[model samples]
Target chain A: MSTLETAAQPEYLCRIAIDPLSRVEGHGKVTLFTDRDHHIRQARLHIVEFRGFEKFIQGRPYWEVPVVVQRLCGICPVSHNLAASKAVDQLVGAHEITPTAEKIRRLMHYGQTLQSHAVHFFHLASPDFLFEFDAEVARRNIGGVMADYPDVARQGVRLRKYGQEVIRVTAGKRVHGTGNVPGGVNKALTLQERNYLLADLDLMIQWGRNIVKLIKQAYALNPGYFSDFATIRSNYLSLVRADGALDLYHGGLRTKNDQGQILFDHLDYRRYAQVLREQVKPWSYMKFPFINSLGPDRGWYRVGPLARINNCDFIPTPLAEDERREFAALGEGQPVHLTLAYHWARMIELLHAAEAIHELLLDPDIFGDELVVRGEMAREGVGVIEAPRGTLFHHYRINEDGLIEKANLIVSTTNNNQAMNESIRQVAERYLDGKELTEPLLNQIEVAVRAYDPCLSCATHALGQMPLYVELVEAETGTVMDCLVRDADGTFRHSG
Target chain B: MSEEQSFTLDGRRVPFQAGQTIMAAALAAGVYIPHLCFNREFAPHGSCRVCLVGVNGRMQAACTTPAAAGQTVESETGEIREIRRGILQMLFVEGNHVCPACEKSGACQLQAVAYYVGMLAPHYTHFYPRRPVDASHPEAVIDFNRCILCELCVRASRDVDGKNVFAVQGRGIEAHLVVNTPSGKLGATDFSIHDKAAQVCPTGAILTKHRGYEIPIGQRLYDRKPISVVGDVATLSESKGGRRHD
Candidate 1:
């Protein structure tokens, strides 16, 4: 009977596509191919948009780069701004900025990281964790979370707002503030700004602790499922202080294996090209960056909050350090490979950011009048920082006229491109393989992608454009069986 | 002075001294005509045409058109405003006036004049011409991209600094500011940061190095008040001891 049934039907491959991924910063799509039995064959995360900020920034004056690069990501403009400013610092030959300048930039960065991580968790990722994966689409959103858990919703809003206030006081405006210049900062923290931030520092720190606890509880609700969902064993990369503590603003590059074995440590980011090579694929506009030693297949690694948490020996702050200890134990003294753990790790870092902000606020040097420093000029400079999502690199070369001759930027999301694809594949195989497709099942793939908090806009270097579409196709005849497009306006349409 | 010569400007009588242009007379009477290339300290170049107004039924640059007793000038009329807005828009598209990234954004006279004339956007296609930034100067940087060919720096260098450090070389769209030095670099020229040419640029063309965003955005020269109330950078520099311009 089985042989007769097999001979009666033709086995053909089918494809499922999720385009213009929602709840992410920019446009991305996922495509999965399966056989007649719905056994997953191939999975790909495609970055469709392209923005050549690196190309257009060429020929601009080097001094304007910090401000110009801020156009890369509105959510993390301060990260780009500070990274470019650090590169420009080398151009101006001020390899070491004044203590006050360093502290001021650190304060700004902490504020940015705090706000960005807050936004990603509370606004984008919380809906998935707070509700069942199979919950109705409308009920598995931020609006649903707000309606059901008003206290959680209110805390998230206040947390993000507090972080923005920190940025406004340190940077100037909460968005594209001109806080950092070539050699140093543009402005010092005023007494009024300092006092205003200080008034809320304790409350923000407490809120940060509360949010971390909230994510912990969310993870505990389904530890077995959460720990294994889209889990993959891969290398992690981030920046760590000279003493092996996590330092978001300034640090040397560090990479570790899945088993928590250090691959490289204390490597100067200026030598990044020596160890890293970006491989381009025809399918996606985003480049796949991998460790040169490992090559593309095994060289590709994870970044951002999870990677930072995994790669660092310890977070310096007391509250975050304790949380880190608990989080690390999840792997039994090894790196946590759970993708959903990104939220837990992100909350820990958010607490660290709040603590860092508190420390910097008390430092008297932040208000010093000596804001800028200068020296002989250099022709080339490279800057790297641990941005909210992951590591960010800004490299530039200038001509004799002080015009930018060339620029290369490897943003955080770009670094995790391969990891994101791998995570999507893992989830697609586990949840989508051999199963009837549904809206909830499709969201599983997105849940994995969102674990990285991927900023497709930042990765693609594109402006405001994000739309997702999904398509199912038959491989034998190359016919699309079903199609779903989520327009840029957030409206969805289903058609064949 | 003898009986002051006066002109009826936008229905207001503006008194003028002998040999003063309508723009100078109107400015002296606390009235703003939304100009770019005209400065009180220099001979009216009348090149930008931003201050164009109807004079007795004919359009003329207020800076070059001499004021006369009982002469009627129309500056605040809808037709005159539209013309001014067009001129401002043209000036914007002609150069790379990225105000958000410009150091002189709030203090820039061209931006102020554009705002005073209600220019909401650059209405024409932008001519994103490649321009060089002369940053070799230790104290000053000249971004040629922001230059509108107003010749204020050229005139200021020649008339006030007594050094012919800058000049406009090309004609029409090809016209651009060039340093008088053989190297064609601002650093190679005998131009000091203190030179009047350094402070006379209507845009971010000529800016002092290491002083960008010094005063922050909200507290800059034009941020606190409209150009109509505070006048241009030159007037503020002259009256307020250059405190506001920088």
Candidate 2:
């Protein structure tokens, strides 16, 4: 792996970079600048890849957008598929889909949320929480979790596989399934497919409860540190049902300030442009989105499990709601700003997804025959959903010929851009400020970023690339003092 | 009539009728020859040379080359398969054929033929040519980027539909399929979704509107069986009385 030029400014006497962040969905770099006394001055997370899916998807037929946009990210393609499908439904003038179609889509979304959060908590983020943050790199991964905690590791794999099976039965494949169409879905759940998913429903729910308990126990081991680690105060945004229930598939927009005060509720998502605006910076490829009323600096907020859990009134499911009550008490009736609490909140959603899947499986609507509905055509449409990562938006304008003239997508990871940077800066200040650069210190920065479970590929719209590099350099002579590279295969080594 | 005409293909004797191409004779005798852009319903176009085989020490397109008495045609040979793979690769790079997101992924003739011939990857830099998509038609959409100059639709519209609604324009790399309409859009023409032209495309270029991925990937035509086993979609549609299972 070749090292690029250090992105250090001349104002700082030293620079440290964590390039090609490991265990994240896509490629990104974190650069920290320090003064002569090794006091870290500034930290920035840089998205180095560029993907222009919005531009390329401009001329495609409106109906193809749901399937074609799945190319954005392999991890959360179902989210993109459903989001684009919802937008296409509006383009076809089907403001509301049929009952069967709605149920099928909800099942697919919950399956996606279940699988995605399972992978993040069990496979990606568990290694850090189960092991010491400064543990050796070799033993700080899923393999190590398997070696030490076999049951936890086995359940994680099974839970993830079960979620994938749910996707397969509903959408037709584990990845890039083609179940959703413009106005509705193309197929309904069959008896065999339903039975296949039902056989594992109870076990998945049981495992879901077990994993949630696992994360809570892990958090309890070091409450003070885990609660304070990478913690920050920022606004939260998500979607909630009209009755103030947490709705992952569809709902009106909601946002809350750092103090848990509602900034907006039941706001029509179609008018999102009236409230949200994106800011582009030269340093990073990911766009910074902020509330239109608050401006860039303070308006920038957090999205994903923590934000969704904090912004919503209650999770509709019984078990997750009980967990939510306990989690809410941690904040003392305010929003929980702890970054590591994200994993705990994420587990709650996983259980909710399991319970939701159980409920949908028992409902006969999923097996109904009326799967599609259509109406008069429209020129413009917008779709918004609470993806596993956070709020995802897909908007499009089509010509009279039904060809897409323009497209704009604000993915879940893009919604967390500024908040991720802030968390990284906070971690850098607390862990590495006025200290010698070490591998453990660098891992702390990554731990903070991974708390958000950022899919950099989705944020940058890139594909087939994730290589991270970390470099510590002397700013005076522009000489590299230390360098570390993490290849795409998740192997790391020291280099010049 | 005396002894039937025959040819030796890959060491197997293939019986043929009078005035039949090598490809026709092979398919008639239940033998598989990898091909694209050649259909049994229409006269052999022989444009996509994926059916190249060694005929008496000469490389020839099986769809256009005639079968003769005792002629030896060597197919499935390593060298011939390599050339076929190269031709398939060029066809892939020449057009923006993104199979993953394509609506006709599993059932597309081009994709099936590529798989049959073991064309693993594009094996060449993609041209990524910018092309236009005409979705004006009420029943169909035409994505010109995926057109491989196969001329199947051009022939189907002109001969079967008798409308002459489709034609090929330009030359060489610039050659493209066009709707023969005053507005140059499929909606402006008298083309119907039932036209043979709509079902004859070997790629995702010409697709029926609002009906994509109706058959799941694993259950689609080529997904269940190889193109060599199930035959091309056009011939299968014809055999099924003009109704496509895909």
Candidate 3:
């Protein structure tokens, strides 16, 4: 989006809207500002679009939402898809899906986390560690990382590729493939696909070793590179399974305040709004989220890396345990409040996920019989699976005629609205140095902002918003400079 | 409540759960609804109106309308009656519903539905769109011209399917199923009929080649009788209050 002209000294405002950020699954944007003191005054995330999938599907059939929304994020489709599918299964009162099928889906969910994390570490954030943060602007890139440590880059690429490959064989196509369904999968995998997946599983072993080495090296060489010029922290949150296992794709909400104390854990999904509430600010369209009890300013619990690491009890995979310990060491153990520690946390999850995927392949019925449980058409249901970004819930109210009358969707990214805003504000306040304002600083802010891997598209959604209004305010006078209801992507239009 | 006005199939009474449609009760009882567009998650959109049946004295579309109390629905009516005949004819005339030569013939729900309604001719003039066939997925195929705008495929895509891959474009009779992506193809977008939403299609509009005939015609759905009879044989735990039995 183009910046509006301000008569008063243009307090450098960078509005970065990246639709379908390359190497990432969904669309989102980052905004930061430098005040008169040149000190960063404000940073906001504008999620203008909304699939309104939640409202759009008020009465839509239950099973379809998972598949439909799974594609919403090409990167982490299965998690949201399964979460929604599971929620739908609960809604209609259908029998639980086969243990094997559910296990396969869980395995797939881990694959999603693995692939998404590798993408962030290798392609998204590697440039900073490879070329020191203080290094020349142009020198920072995948090329820079490869120039010094080719093996790290290669391993990262291979690990991510293995994750995508796992999705391909079990689900069919690599990105948002078929095979997952409410009752069960459409078709069981063939022996060939199964064997191929197991063989491919070995690649992550070598790749995971490289991941540890790289993270350790980055910490040792330039610990400050991972340091927070943007000193900030927020309450962390995540989901856990019934057995108290770390639930990536299936779990209720759990949260911890910045003080490193568990605030809430194992809250039922139906009452998610009771704990997490939306807070939309006038400056930006993106809705800020907070613990409902505390309200807006007081509630700022973060989801994703910070949340998952703080909330999860034990890392299922052994390799990931050491990485987690190393991360805890950064912020002095217990509940690490340092936001940059998200990088380390994300890596540990990736390492753990790779192992989970391997374990899933070993299940005898991974491609065995019982793909679907045949059913009558009149059943109503809700599916609640976790998207890579956050918790995704799909609720369907099917009419006797079996038509969709209403649909309610609560996606994962939206689950972190409040924490996202607070994180942005803290980062902006800390990093926006007054004197020398360069674009690289702004870009790094965007990248660091993305370290959380926000899914604004999934959060803002689509088709749900008919007309999105963009109101520009003059920072000096604090007056409404101009209010235009721009079409969702920030293209100002006279008409809706 | 004493006699219960009970109905049983093979000594087992369907629960006939309240709010539960005959289809759901039947499926719960292991009975199947021969529907193409009806998926579990999405709200039913009964545009194709193929799932028409007689409830009590009136006729209604199974997917859109409700299954009320003390209702008896006929899946197969003698002579393929006006509503079923009209639905079949319109379905035939709407798309390139050319059977026999088409791969989905024999196993197709349109053909099966047409057979159930005893449809022999396309009474209305054919207004076929010279639409291209989209066989994009290395596995799946999409032939627009041969499609019967049943919207089950469309509904499946949006509601149950989730991807919203298929959409109804062009108004009125001019409407045809268009792929939501740039290429206007299923493969281009994330779609595979392998799922219930995609595979639930009834007509030749969305067919899976190998799975068919593989089950044999005599044993195939609707061939033994209508879905109502097959559906009736499966319902269990008959509801004491008025419930739907197709």
Candidate 4:
């Protein structure tokens, strides 16, 4: 009999696991399986918890949907806030909101993107990039980054603080603000608040440029290493303005295939159900979303920073446009599929956000008194926005009494599930070996997953405490052989 | 009642009337005991448990426990604070407390109490329990999902409004507030927006109609200051009982 067929043998079983994956917003685990010969067979990323938000929201008032769903993720509440607001706006029968309301919503969205992207780059992903992934666990962290490159670390902190300040000044607080409403925002920006944000524009713009410059320097240090790391070619999706310029707040849905060919463009988001559908996998609480034309397997597409940068023809702002061109060049006349490119694209978007904020602040309409537009009620509506991570879809159906009958939310990370798995497999094949399971090898898997900056919290509507444990197990007996425990602060040590 | 008595509250000698509970004495003396469902206008209902305080090295609900002379009452102590946070966590998990989406968020006593007690994250498992929202009332809505079972509405409806329109119907986790009407609908009852019961909800469970965001969130009662400073102010300000658009 073939050794691979020997299922009863305990020693022949092989599994590698990274539980409660670190640095991400919420709980997730990675499990790698190999055959008896130790040939890697499959690698799967499992979302362990489910919040059942869709099921629980059944009888909630439609007006409350926006505010309630924002609780899904403290890291990206504004995305859910605005997405739910847009969906309810349709239900309220206001096809277009007032000019002032639109500007305020746009401002909030930009603030969210800037803050979320900053936290990911500085707090979550930068440690792996700045310190080599193989560096000592203690020395490879924000503290280490601070000790070695104090200026860069300081800038990152200051930049994130500035983004948070924008959110606080505009939305009432840094997280779970009650500023957004169904037809528009609750209130307009006062001149004092506007001036407060505008005063920091110069410093923020400079810091954004410095961040892009710093990323370029890091890329220069190891051009070939990042260029070929965890690369996966797939279809990309995002929102674009009518002229095909990048738009985060309101626009038509656009998607491109791996060859940089536009699969579709300028499609109405309200008609999303006709062209898009989600397929649930038993392995994950998160659903895999794909274009209806391509079916589940072939239809899988990528979303978030790299996807947005790739799918958009141009950015509206000049500084970000320049960076966009430079980024596009790295694709070698095609789409850039290197997972590491997400970090670089994120910086470019950050610059665009600062520029966009500056532009919005300059407009006098931002100070208008007209904040909300109450319209006739409708039964159903859909809202879509390009969240910091990617395009987010919130669809709701309400009864005559204005209570939610159903709610289906396709968060940013759900769209990337297939691509994330593919990237993990590619990473596993490159670094995971039966001979050894080192921390750096595990970090390689982490780096690949971190590229997407997946917020499993939002993706799965998850909350509560999770145990962070890594295990090397025997698949036959389902027994843990060796384990590593990760503390809440992201430090790891051998548990067994 | 006899002469006035005083207790050491968080190291401050706060004087109280003989008949007053620790929560009432604290509020009367300008000291805040963070609470929900214990309105100054109504009798004490310690159903929320957010006002738990350390008294003589033992935990007790400040709203229900009478202030004793010379007794050491610790409301702001770490152990007391942790207990309050645990109560808040339980309320958060037991019901659908989506603060971001609720109309009463900034003005909500439960939300403000949560903030005051430093319950930064809902550190417990979310029940995500499927609850009902009753929008049958034209001038008000009752979202049972946000109910913390404080019984303020039931007390106000029964005693203050003289309507007897609401009551607690079930027990344990299944315990819930129910409408007292032939059709079991708020719309079918004489529950008006002007009812005292409608204005007494600590959470968004009972909200006035068409007044969502009447005042922008930042300028709301609790938003203007921490709940510690705005204690009972959200309820006391409603004595005037009229909406003002800021």
Q: What is the lDDT of residue B57 in candidate 2?
A: 86
Per residue, candidate 4 scores C-alpha lDDT tens digits across B49-162 of: 888888998888999999889999888888788988998998899998866566776677788788888998899999898777788887788888788888888888899899
User: Per-prediction interface RMSD?
Assistant: 2.3, 1.6, 14.0, 2.2
lDDT of 2 at A316: 95
- lDDT of prediction 2: 0.86
Docking class of 4: acceptable
lDDT of 3 by residue, A92-179 (tens): 4445677667776776678778887787788767776666555654345565667777887787788888888777666655775545
Ranking by lDDT: 2, 1, 4, 3
Could you give the CAPRI-style class of model 1?
Answer: acceptable
Which of the predicted structures, 1 or 4, would earn the higher lDDT when compared with the native? Answer: 1
lDDT of 1 by residue, B20-129 (tens): 88988888788988888888899998988888999999999999999988999998999989998998898888888998777677778888888888998999999888
lDDT of 2 by residue, B145-179 (tens): 89988898999999999999989999888888888
DockQ of each: 0.46, 0.52, 0.03, 0.38
**Least well predicted 10-residue stretch by lDDT in candidate 4 chain A:** A1-10
TM-score ranking from best to worst? 2, 1, 4, 3
Where does model 1 exceed 4 Å of error?
A1-13, A459-468, A475-478, A485-493, B134-140, B161-165, B178-194, B209-211, B235-246
In angstroms, the error of model 2 at B4 is 3.4
Give the 10-residue window scoring lowest on summed lDDT in candidate 2 chain A: A1-10
TM-scores for every predicted model: 0.92, 0.94, 0.61, 0.82
How much is the TM-score of the A chain of model 3? Answer: 0.81
